[model samples]
Structure formats: C-alpha cells, structure tokens
Target chain A: MNDPGRRLPSGSEPVPDPADGPTDGPAGGLTGARSSDRTRAAILRAARAHFARHGYERTTIRAVAADAAIDASMVMRYFGSKENLFDAALTIDLRLPDLAAVARDDLPRVLVRHFLDRWEGDPADDALLLLLRSAVTHERAAERMREIFAEQVAPALGEAVDPRRAGLVSAQLLGLALTRYLLRAPGVTALTPDEVTELYAPALAAVLS
Target chain B: MNDPGRRLPSGSEPVPDPADGPTDGPAGGLTGARSSDRTRAAILRAARAHFARHGYERTTIRAVAADAAIDASMVMRYFGSKENLFDAALTIDLRLPDLAAVARDDLPRVLVRHFLDRWEGDPADDALLLLLRSAVTHERAAERMREIFAEQVAPALGEAVDPRRAGLVSAQLLGLALTRYLLRAPGVTALTPDEVTELYAPALAAVLS
Candidate 1:
C-alpha cells in the first residue's frame, strides 16, 4: 500500500485502496505482497484513461496520481516523468494477423477482415485515437504517432510485401482504421464487421500483389 | 493594437499573440472602430493555428485571444463560445469532382486521382485532422467530425452508389486521408498521387458498380 496521507485531485473520489480491498494481497503474510505489480497495473490503467480521455497535455502526473490513489512521488518513482508514462501507456502491439500466411487471392479480404475485426472488437483498444487526438494539437504527439506507425506496423508488413510497396498498404490499412474507428463515419461505422472484411479484402489483395 | 490591459495564461507560449501590434483604427475607436473585421480575421487565423497545432481543449479561448492580440471577451462577443468557434474554424467544403462525368470504366482512376490530389495538396486543408486530433479528448470534436462526414461526404456519394456500398467508399477514401495525411505513415505517404489513383480506382469503380 502507498503512503495513505496524500491528498488526491479535485472531482475524483478515492475508492477503497485496492491493496486493502478485495483485490488485496493474501492476508496470511508480508511475503505474499505483490505491491509492485499492483502499482504498475494501477499506473497503466490511470495513464490510459488520462491519455484517452484528456489527451497528453491535459493529463498531468498529479492528475494521474490522484486517479490511482497513489502519491505523486510514487508515480515519478515508477515512470520517471509524464513522457515516460505516455511512452509506456501508448506502447501497444496492434497484433495484426500474418498476411503472408493468407491465401494470395484472398489476401485483401483477409487483411480487411482482420483489420475490421480488430477495429470493431474494442473501441477502447484505440491507441490511434489517442494519438490522433493528441497529434492534432501537439507537435511531440504528432512526431510520436508517426514514429510508431513507421517503426512498428509498417516494417512488419513490409516484410511480407515488397518493402517498396509497404507504405501504400500501410497507408490504406491505417486509413481504414482512422475512418472506421476514430472518425466514426456513418458510412464507415455502419458496416457490419463481416461486410467490411468482404468489401475490402480484394482491395488489400490488390495492394499486396 | 491589442489592449495591454488583458491577462492570459502564462504557460501557453507556443501560441503567438496576433492581436497585440499597432492597429489602423483611431486611438479612441476601441469599441466602435469597425475593427471587428480585423478582430474576426485574427480570431480565424488564431483559431486555425491553435486548432491545427493543439486541437480543441488545449487551444483555450484565452490562448487564441492572446495569440490574436484580443481580449477573450472579444472572442465571446464575435463567436459566442469555444464550441461555436471550433465549428466555424473547422467548416470545409470538400468540392468532390464530377465522377458522373467520367467514363464508366475509368471512374475509379478518376476518383483515386482526385482523392490523391486533394489529400496531398495541402496538409492544412484537412478538417478531418483537426477533428481527429481533438476528438479523443473532446466529445464535441468527435461529434462534429462524425456529423461532417455523415452529412457532407456520405450524402453526396450515397447518391451514386448503393446506400450500403457508399460507406465502403467513405472508409476507403477517408482511410487514405487518415493514414497518408494525418498519420504520416512512410509507406502511405511514399506513394505518388498517380500511383494511389491507379491502385484505388478499380476498387472505387467496383463499389459504384
């Protein structure tokens, strides 16, 4: 448990401390204490909320500390700074399916389907939304969003397609996510996940081929 | 010239004060100077800069007023509120090409070519980027972005394609904007406008057909 005396931020009511509550360590002994794991989880959850809801600039360490019911100093001890926390919070692996393993003729459909599924499965799984939201307003956020797509999603897919064409495929696929997920275009969001997969698969196949 | 009597947030330095320098109005004409035109222009310029740079919430009215060298009260006098100012600032007419005039088989190419041209033409012409950047953190921004696409782009294209199929076009075209322009994915941005037109046109034709 953290030092209990710290005053939290305004507008947030502190829940019963999780360590002292049902999610607590086994009551038998101190050796069962997993305070470190609990603390990390708390910080991550709070950080994600802050980033997703208030964006990067509005999300301060003091605000996050208050939300997590932990000391502000404890947050710094764990994550170093707001930038470090943001880096950790935004570190998500999209886990896109292996396109090379898909049938060549069905590649577009498969890719589209996979992407639609990922998009529809969870609205909250949107790090892109968080990034897009922040990027519009902040230079650092824009730089980071670009860097992640370049370093992570593009390189992995570029391995399957020719490296030269990877950017095109990445652009289309990421664009699908942006329109369908973040923008929530009625035209984009209205499609059933299956319909999206069906319609866009051939397009994906064309890009890959 | 801006009234030096105004107070503004100290932490917001990236926002420049566009309202502060010398003005053409008479010295005693602060209230009735017809300087509202200048004030309105400054507000628009400041709004675009703030919305383009930081998005909605962080781009405070006070920050914009400071940037415009006007008092926050002047912004309220002209635009009513931040939400109204954002609506005015983000308004855009897509002015899509006449797809109906193109040869049937060549429609996709035409569509893709047009999209690529517009998407790449000016990074700042994007109302979508403005919305995306502000949406994650601000619900109003999200709603407005959704409304624009649903009301403007979708209706125009929905007339050409099946209502059901039109959304796919929205998804594809918008996806291009999100990935290529906003996200700045290397693979996405690397494609020449012509290549994108070539690659995407057939798919677009299919949707229409």
Candidate 2:
C-alpha cells in the first residue's frame, strides 16, 4: 500500500465535500490535485528510465527516487518494492494496428513501419524497448515479453498465419529492436529508420505471407 | 599475457626434442601429453559454460576452476587473467558453408540448418551464445559481438545482398538466437530444430535474395 496520508487525507475536515472533486472544485483545489498526479507521473517516468538503462537486478528504488528528485521512501510508499515498481514501470501498450483490415500483401510493411515509428518516435513512450533492454538478462522481463507477444501481437495477426509463423514474425520484429536499439550493433545502428523499414519490410512480408 | 610458467615450461634439458611432439612421440609419452591436453580442454569447456551462464561480469576464474575440478591457480596458469581466458574460450568458427557454391535458392535452408546444427549440436561448442549472454550487459562482450558480426558474418554474406540487408539478415538470425536460446521464450523454444529450419529458411531466403 502507498502512503496512508495520501490515500486518506487526515482529519482536516469534519465531513468530505463533494465539491472537492475536480469537476466541481475551485481552480486552486483542482491545481493541487493535478500537482499530486504530476508527482506520481514523474516517479513512474524515472522508474522506467532506470529500468531501461540498468536491468532489473541492478536498478534500485533509491536510484529511481534520486532520478525523480524525491525521497526513497516516497518511491516505496508509491510502488511498494523494486519488483512491484518494475511491474508498474513496464506498463507497455504495443499499439499494434488492426492488421485484419489491411490488405494481406501490405501487412508486413505496415507492421514494420509501425514498430520503426514506435521505437524512433519518442524514447519516453517506448515501453517495448524498455522491456526488451531488460528481457535479455532478466527472467521477469523475458516472461513479460512473452506475454506481450502472445497477448498483443498474436491476436492481432489472428488466424491469418500459423501460430508458429506468428511467433517467428515476433522474433524478427523483436530482433530488430535487440540489434538496433538495445545492442546498438554497428550495421543495424547505421541505418536510418527509413532504410531499416525499406530493408526489413520485405522480409516481414515473406514471413507474413 | 597469461602465466609465464605455463607459456615457458621449466627445462629438464636445453635441447628441444622433435620426438616429444605428439606426431612422433613414443606411445606412453603421447598418452601423457594427450592427458594434459584433455585437462586444458576441460578447463576451457568449463570456462565457456560459466561465461555463458554468468556473463563477463560475474564469471570468476575460481568458479571456473571449481567447475572443471582443477586448482584455481591452474586456471590462471592456463588462461592468465579472466580477459585472456574469455578470449581463449570464444574461439568460434561459424564454419558457414560456401554460399556461392550452393544453389541460389537453397542458400536459406543451408544457412538456417547450419546455424541450428551448430547451436543444438553441443553446449561446449556454443561460444556465440556465451557472447550473446555477456554482450547485453558487458561493454567488452558487446564490442566483441560487433567484431564477430562485422568480421565473420558480413564477409561471409559478401555482396550476396546489399550490406544493409546483410546486416538485417544477421539481425534476424541473432534475434532468433536471442529469443529461443538466450531468453528461452516458450513459443520459440517449443519448436524443434527442424521446425525452426523449415519456418525460418524462407524468411532468410527473402533477406538473401
């Protein structure tokens, strides 16, 4: 559980006021509620960056707190422990497109282009990359990776291909991330996102078709 | 440099004897030399397993010696420092078949089969997996991985495809290794080697052609 004080604001008033709710609140009170949300968001952001850079084993609540510029207890009060914090930090949404609607021939290009955009677009929004950087060395992250592939990727591909082939497709996509983003392999890194999509889309097309 | 004593044995007599060489030795002396060779091989084997399991940071010489049932000092004598030992352990020969000689269409199946055989053949022979496990976390291992890709894989593919596509091919191959072997993702691991070869060969063919 997080801080009791934050959850049940102490006996400062005899009765709760419905007007305190943001929709009915004075501007000052709404700003105060917004500030609390901002702090929570900041902690989550710092935890994600730490987990991304250092693996599950090496990342510490204290370091995440330091990065967030808050006390270490504040981290514990919010997330409970390092493991729970990791679970909180890795709330990934693949945002996979509706492949069923696309022309079968275009699935590979569409999928490849989407991932390239996801990875290169904004570092903060790239939760998949965060999981990937940790997954190679950490078992928890790897399990989460498997779940992501199964839950988000597999169903999206639907019955269009065999399940095994779908798994292979995930392997290829994750492999690109592993080389270009995580390992920073020279050749993979040297390509522009457009170049990667150009070179990689056809291969994905082969797997898809 | 490793231990000087191992490199330069203390002399019983100054003159070098041609008969002492394994090729022309008395049967009894040859057996003794072969036994020594086996011990060295055992140490190297244990070292590879340790490095594969623990990565560069955690694998210690003492631990390798323990696994091999040799004195810790013998490990040092044979390998010098952990760095030199790692170098000795990772003497990988991809032994890639001659792509040019193969029928153009069959290149994918051959390459995929070769890698599957190499990976599943023997744990002792899997230095690339060891490097992959270490490279994610260790800077030195990552550099070595880059060199292996550039020097070995790139040259082998050699103008068969564009350089960037060659890199993508490597990414796909390495990604399979990452997911199936290192991460042990269940979906990828559930497939037999033949199944892998059958499924992966065509995707690779796309990359190559």
Candidate 3:
C-alpha cells in the first residue's frame, strides 16, 4: 500500500524537465536524442503523479498530458496507452546501499532506516508507491513490482546473506508500508522513525543474518 | 496475493444448493426464515467464488446469481448492488486461539504455526484472502481488512505481547501472506509450514515477550 501524499527520494531519477524545449542545446540537431529523453522523463514524472493520486482505473492520458504540459496526442505517441504509461512510470531504483560496505552489526539499522526515509519523505512523486498501490489489482503491475525486488533487492542482498532471504526482506518492509502508511494501523503508525528503526531493524536483521 | 487454483478450507460455508427449492423445507411456511438464511448463504458462497475467480470488478451480480442457480432479479433484491455483495462477501472470523491458556515458551510456535496453518490449509473459502486481494483498490475493503486485524489479531496477540506489537504482528504475517501466496515470492513459498515456524517464530517471539 502507498500514500499519495508521500514522495520518491529526490534526485532518484533524472529531474524531469519543466519545459519541453531544447533551449540548452545549441543548433538542437545533435541534442535531439537527449531532448527526446527529457520529454519522456517529464511524461513519466507526470504519469507517476497522476497514478499516485488516482490509481490505475482513474488516471487518464489526458490528465497526464495536462500535468506534463504536453498534448494528449504526444502522450499516446510516447506510451501507446494508459497501460504502457503506467508500466513505464513504475520503473524505480531503490538505491540500496552496498551491504558489503556497511559494518555487519550496522547492516540492520541501515536497511531499516533506508526504507523509512524513502517512504516517509516529502510529497512530490513516488513510482514505487504507485506500483504498490496499483499492483493489487493489475497482474502486470504486480509482476513488475516483483521484478524490481528480485532484480534490485535479491542481488543486493546476495552480497551479505542468502539471496533467497531477499524476498522475505521485501515482504517485511512492504508489509510495514502496508500497515503504517496504507492501512494506517494505530500501532506502528504512531512510532517515530527512530522508534521504527529500533523495533524493526532486529526483525529485518534476523532475515539478513 | 492469492492463487486462483487454491481453495478456501472445505466446509467453511454451507455448500451451495445445486437446486434452489423448498424441497427440503416442510410445508415452506414454518421454514421461511430458515429458507431465507439458506438462500443468503448460497448467494454468498457463489459471490465468494465469483469474486475469487474474477475479482471485484469483473464479477457481476448476474454471474453470481447464475452460479448460485438463482435469478438475477433475486440477486439484486438480496444484495442491492455488486458493491454491497462484495462487502457482505468479505465477512470472516479468524477463529483465533485463546493465547492466555498457552504456555510462554510455546507461544511463538503457536502463533507462527497458527497463521501458517490458516494460510496454507487446503482451499475452500478464505474471506481474509479475498479481502487482501480487493483491499488494494477499494477504500472500504481496506478499512474492513484493518478492522479484521484489529479485532481478531490485536487482541489475540495482546494476551502475550505488550498489546502494542499486535499491529506489527499483523503486518508481519500479512506481509508474509503477500509474498508467499499472492506474490509467490521464491523464499517463503519454498519453506514448509514447519520451516516457517522454526524461522519466523523466534522473530515473532521477540515481539511477544
């Protein structure tokens, strides 16, 4: 589960450009591919914002275009459909710290705090949260979410523990997100970040070791 | 997450009557209330099946009625709308054990084994799993899910834990369900129930005492 009010960690993706212009490129021809890349990023950013707020069923191409300050035709041209746009927007990098670099005892605290910081950050855009919210109903979305975990988390954890345990780590943290943010369950929601770190790190550490 | 191929525990509901009739009721007049109750149960059973197979959106009143061998008009009359039927279908009881009666050292084993058993049991009908599947998109479904955990899980755990960790306990197990069953993540799904108890019970026991 996800909160629309929360955001992705800032600077995680190429900061989406506000304008659709190639003003930074002289003569423009050489920068054509870069300009296209910027436009795509801007569109994905807008799509994440819409999906985060409205979810899969309600978020429309027109709404995303309006937010990106582009035409609906351009939105369709880039993404083909609402479904494609949702998929493209879901791409995320967890930016996990190298577990091999961190001290063994500090591993649990680092893992716990990393997730809390990302999930608890300020409002703007969060693709992973959008995926979490939408994945419950959409099979493709669920697959992509798992792919993100398996590719990023499982391998990252392989450096420190059995890679198999990585899925459990995903489960533990994602479940925490569900209760604290999504379900707004009274118990864990009341705990501060420091308290969460103190309480959950051990549980996660158990999986890590 | 849920597997469509799996079933809820058997005999959890009155088997839907293949024939809708007053054949079993003597004279019909004295069994009016009893007949009505049976009809309600049959509709609910069929509703659960449809919702389970097709999920909340694709599942239709007509389909549920057809499955129950009842008229679509009767389905509308009884449940009012698909939303109402979805709400009614989500009702469940976890049938938690009285934790106060169990010994301290066995509490973690008991709690872990309990959830593993309920989640892993032979399929028939599982309302909680249905709620978990639907709650992702529907606000009301999410509310009901949290309520179920608070009402059943929190108090059951309060008998052993500090009463605060109950929410964490819910988060922990539900997350496990998400991975093992819904997401079918590689790690926990591979573990037998006994292995899950051995690995997770200590983690849970830490929360308990």
Interface RMSD of each: 2.8, 1.4, 1.6
Please, what are the lDDT tens digits per residue for candidate 1 over residues B85-181? 9987766555666655767677667667666554444332434455555554456776776676677656656365676566666666766766565
Better of 1 and 2 by TM-score: 2
The list of candidate 3 runs beyond 4 A from truth reads A1-35, A122-125, B1-5, B8-34, B122-125
TM-score of 2: 0.82
Q: Provide TM-scores for the models.
A: 0.72, 0.82, 0.83
- How close to the true structure is residue B11 of candidate 1, measured as C-alpha lDDT? 30
Model 2 lDDT tens row, A1-209: 21111211111222222112223345465676665555566676677766766666787989878877889998898788999988866767778888899888888888988987667653434356567766766778878888888898888998868778888888899888777765677778778777777778888877766
Count of backbone collisions within predicted model 2: 0
Worst 10 residues of 2 chain A by lDDT: A2-11
Model 3, residue A120: distance off in Å is: 1.5
Model 1, range A43-130, lDDT digits (tens) per residue?
7667766776766766899988887889999999989999989877666556667655766676667666665555444333444455
DockQ of each candidate's interface versus the true one? Answer: 0.37, 0.48, 0.52
